[model samples]
Target chain A: MDMDMSKNMERVMKDKQEGLEEWSTIIKPKTSVWNLYIKEIWAYRDLLILFVKRDIITVYKQTVLGPIWFFVQPILTTLVYIFVFGGIAGISTGGIPKPLFYLSGIILWNYFADCFTLTSDTFIKNQNIFGKVYFPRLILPLSIVVSGLIKLAIQFTLFIAFYVYYYFQSGIAPNYSAILILPYLLLLMAGLGLGFGLIFSSLTTKYRDLKFLIVFGVQLFMYATPIIYPMSSIGVTAKEILFYNPLTHIIEAFKYGFIGEGEFNGLGLVYSGVVTFIVLTSGILLFNRTEKSFMDTV
Target chain B: MSKVVLKIENLSKRYRLGEVGSGTISHDLNRFWAKLRGKEDPLSQVGQVNDRTAESISDYVWALKDINFELREGEILGVIGKNGAGKSTLLKLISKITSPTTGSIKAKGRIASLLEVGTGMHPEMTARENIYLNGAILGMTKSEIKKKFDEIIEFAGVGLYVDTPVKRFSSGMRVRLGFAVAAFLEPEILIVDEVLAVGDIEFQKKAIGKMKDVSSNSGRTVLFVSHNMSSIKTLCDSGLVMSNGTVSFKGDIDSSIQYYLGNSKNLNSFKSYENLDEKPGSKDVDLLEYKLIDKEGEVIDSFNLYEEVSVQMKFHIKKLNGKIYPNIHVLDKYENYFLVDTIPENEIPKETGIFISTFKFPKYIFNTGEYSIGLAVTSFPGSIVHFFENPAIIFNVTEDDLSLRIGPSTGMLPGVTRMQLQTKTLKI
Candidate 1:
């Protein structure tokens, strides 16, 4: 063992000297922002699936309701909103039944809200592992969004059940026009949530003051979004103000697609979709830059 | 020549060392001023002497200064340093977890780091789910993870609990599962920092073995940071010794080890002797200071396979009641609790004030490592009236032929006892 180590040690010493000289002369530290974000993240798709699965399982684990909590949370929250906003406050639902009315907005909104809240603080929460490892940072928020989708799926099943029951009771159903736009609406909601969430995640890495802002801001944002009352219920001036909130078109379109009673304008939907695209693109760019050096700030 | 896979050049990192939020406003103002001056940064003052006590001294200090190195494919690089050294900071920079304040790094292949096992394992997620999640965070494809899924679970040894949520798993189990996923990951460049510090002894060994296999078998480059010199000698082919935020030595593991052990050994005795004063000594006398130095009058940081070092001692005799003999004892650095003591009874004296003694190792046949020296004054029979235990006059031994032969993965032999032996083979 001694003889072998000595020989190896000599070779290593020679190599180290040569390596240092070579490194000093030829190496240039440059980061490929685009390649790193898209390619590296694409490779780690398996981990994302695991993260998504972990999110879904852990949320329900040890609870008596298990996976049923996914269904129950949206159902219960929607029922409360119906009592408070629909029955007591006399908020209009654009002629859709209150349970169906609130459940559609609540389920879709829940997915976006959860994605935003989880992804907004990605670096702060994952600082322990992030400091120690080298992997694509975007994978953290990407996995959160993916995992949120799984929960959204579970809740959507309950929404379908409620829709079917209401359909039989009223002898009315979602028109073909509404059914065709369901996938698009889902994508829009995810894109917006992911974009905004990543923007905050990047900012929170440095300031940390943004964390409180995000938590409180999201709560107030819930009111601005057409989740509780349909867009049609608001007067003309108030409707114009709500139209400026990009989430308004998203939720309004989702309700209109499901219940066939809420307002949906092409110009508004296009404007919101464009906003989602820009937000997501900028978010990705910021997240890419932030992930590289959040260790120093966070 | 082997392929060079990773290169770092002129890398320097500046860190604000005190009061996290206090520097924010100053940093922003500096940034604004720099922009006004059309310069990159306003605070680029170099060689401004570090008056650590003064308020005018900038909070910023270079965490790393002109660090440069390269690694061949399949080579395991051991980064060794004391606390506040730039070892972890180097890893962070290479991993892109943080950017360098100045300089650049170029790596040829995909890198995966076990910076910490289970970085983002959601407590609510099952082990099975967490494995996937952690894998993704590590940049492994689903198919890649699936292929290794069974192997990972088996390696973690968690068995049927793979499907259970990770929060339910014990800390050890969580670590095991996390390590299993990370170790199974096959990236082109693998970086690990003191991760083997976790789990039981057996698991640590297993983790080290896995790291070795990853680097050796797959031709992957590995960068490992650790304070355990023995482990560095056992696991790394090359070494980078960092001191005070600079690459003090870089080369063959032996030379780097020699440089590190040498620089640190001299300081040990001073600290130990200073600390020894805190322990109340005999009423009559006190052992104030102790140290070890070499033939050239240099403090012996370490030794060769067969070398000599001198243990020098000094003390003050407040008032001597009777005759007392001085004794010198030696211990391995890792095991300073016990010692081998030799008394100079014949040289005893009834003292009044200052005293000094020197013990020599004419042929200090110790392995290349760290050893501690202790000093004491004893009465005629056996009772030690005053002593400074492990008063750290330390040294390391280096033998080029011997270290290379031991190879990587040998357990870190912690002391000098490995030195006091000889081996021979006789044919029957």
Candidate 2:
């Protein structure tokens, strides 16, 4: 053992002329804001995938229903919206069936809500692992985004079942061309949620008051979006104010595509896309600045 | 002359002592304004010079300060220190758990930290799933974990319950599984902080052996922080002693331990009370002098590892009410009582007298450490103590050259004593 160690040392000493850049990792006092470490994120994609798997498989472990809770949550929320907004409040669904109208909006809205609330808690919840190991800190919030997508996919099936039922019974037709934009709509929602979540998670590390504001804030923000009520049913002033909320356009487009009702515009989708890009970029910048030293405050 | 794989330069970490909340935002704003004006961070000046004796503690502390060290490939360096000596802080900085306030920790290849086992484990997940999950968290690819999956399970000795949820496993099994995942991490540099302090002894031995194997076979560097001196002494190639946020000593394993132990604040090795009124004793008995002497009757402040030394305590018994049992208590530096030797019954005094009670230690008795003696006189039954002086005099037992003679003094000699046991050995 001694001889082997000595030989290794001798070889290392002989290579002392190697430049400083030969070191694989160089931890410095400050990391520049521009270097987002996107490649490192790709390198640890396996961990990100496994994290998403953990969130999905272990969410309801030991419970009899398991992932059935995923479908139940959106189904229950859709029923409540149909009763309170469609039946009691006499809100117009733009002639679309109540279940189909509510299910589409609820599924899209739930995805954003879940992603925002959970991603916002990234730092505080995963400080244990973050403090112990060095992986792309971005993986945590990304996993939340991906897991949210998985849930949306499962709930999308339930929404499709309602859409198919309504279509066969009443011969209602969805704009197939508008439905093709679903993938892009899903991306916008994830971007908005992840962007907002990262900013909050980073801020909450130092000041935890933002943590308590999240659940309440997300609920209030949902009311501002065109989820329960159709964009055409509300007053023009109300619709104009709600349009400023980027989620309004995304959810409206989602409703238009599947139910062939609610508001949809190319310019509005473009505006939401730009807002998501800004929020996600700024969020990534804030997250990058925070991940390096958040453990101290956290 | 081995190539250094890890080099740290001027590494310093300043921590906010109290609530790092909105109250500090004002300070941060002040620092930001100063930095904008090409001035140094105002908060950075707080810990530059530690006024340890100041009347009030500062709101910021330097958890580590200007630490500089280098680790060669395949070198296992043990970091030992008292709590709050910046040992864990050093590990934290190296692992990038928290960024340094100022400095750089440059290293070759991947640096993996086992700061704690099962760091990201979800209790509801099964062992098989946790293996992949934890391995991935530790930076192993799925295919890599699958490749070493069987080896990890075999090493952990938990093959029977691979599919069982981790919550069902005992705490020991959980630790074992966690350690197993980390053991196969195979990073260029591994930072382990007291992970071995848990788990059973057999597993600890296995882990220790595995570390030695990993370093020697793969030429990987490992930085281990543990309070267990024996483990450090046995496993590390060199040692670093930390004290009060700085490197106090860096040398071979044995001398580093010596420096840490001898650094204990015990200025005087002999204590004597010349004035009768100020003696450390009860009214009946007063201690005159407490000191250590060798077999040649020469006074010495420190004892050699293989030297025959005696602790002699002289006291004046003004008045005796019952049989007095003069005893000497030997304690390690941390005040852990090792042994107490009382005078034989026949040697006990029955009346008032000026008596010198001596307790002798045979050669090669004490291991290397700082020790102190407690003098007391108690009655035999129920040990009624009349007068006692705890830690009356402090002395150190330091090591000498191996030529002094021994059976075999290898990497470490644990325990407070090195007593020689006699036995008859033939074919057996």
Best DockQ among the predictions, by candidate number = 2
Show pairs that collide, candidate 2: A9-B2, A12-B3, A13-B3
What tens-digit string does per-residue lDDT give for candidate 1 at B214-288? 778889889988877877888899888787778766777876676667556436643222222243357766775
Summarize candidate 2's per-residue lDDT along B320-428 as a digit string, tens digits. Answer: 8677888888898878888988988798887787888888888877778888888888875666776788877677888767666556655567887877778678995
Instruction: Kindly report which residue stretches of model 2 are placed more than 4 angstroms away from their true locations once superposed.
Output: A1-16, A19-21, B46-57, B264-428
lDDT accuracy of residue A270 in candidate 2: 93
* Winner by lDDT: 2
Among the numbered candidates, top TM-score falls to 2
- Relative to the unseen true structure, what is the C-alpha lDDT of residue B123 in candidate 2, on a scale of 0 to 100? 92
**What lDDT score is found at residue B222 in candidate 2?**
95
Residue A228, candidate 1: Cα error in Å is: 2.0
Residue-by-residue lDDT tens digits, candidate 1, A181-239: 77777788888889999999988877778899988898899998888888777789989
- Candidate 2 lDDT at B279 equals 66
| lDDT (tens digit, per residue) of candidate 2 on A1-298 | 9999999887676675654447789999898977988989998999999999999998888889988998888888888988899889988888888888888878888899888889889999888888788888999999999998998888888877887788889878678899899899999999999999999988999889998899899988878987777788888899779878999988888777777787788888999999999999999999999998998888
What TM-score would you give candidate 2 relative to the actual structure?
Answer: 0.77
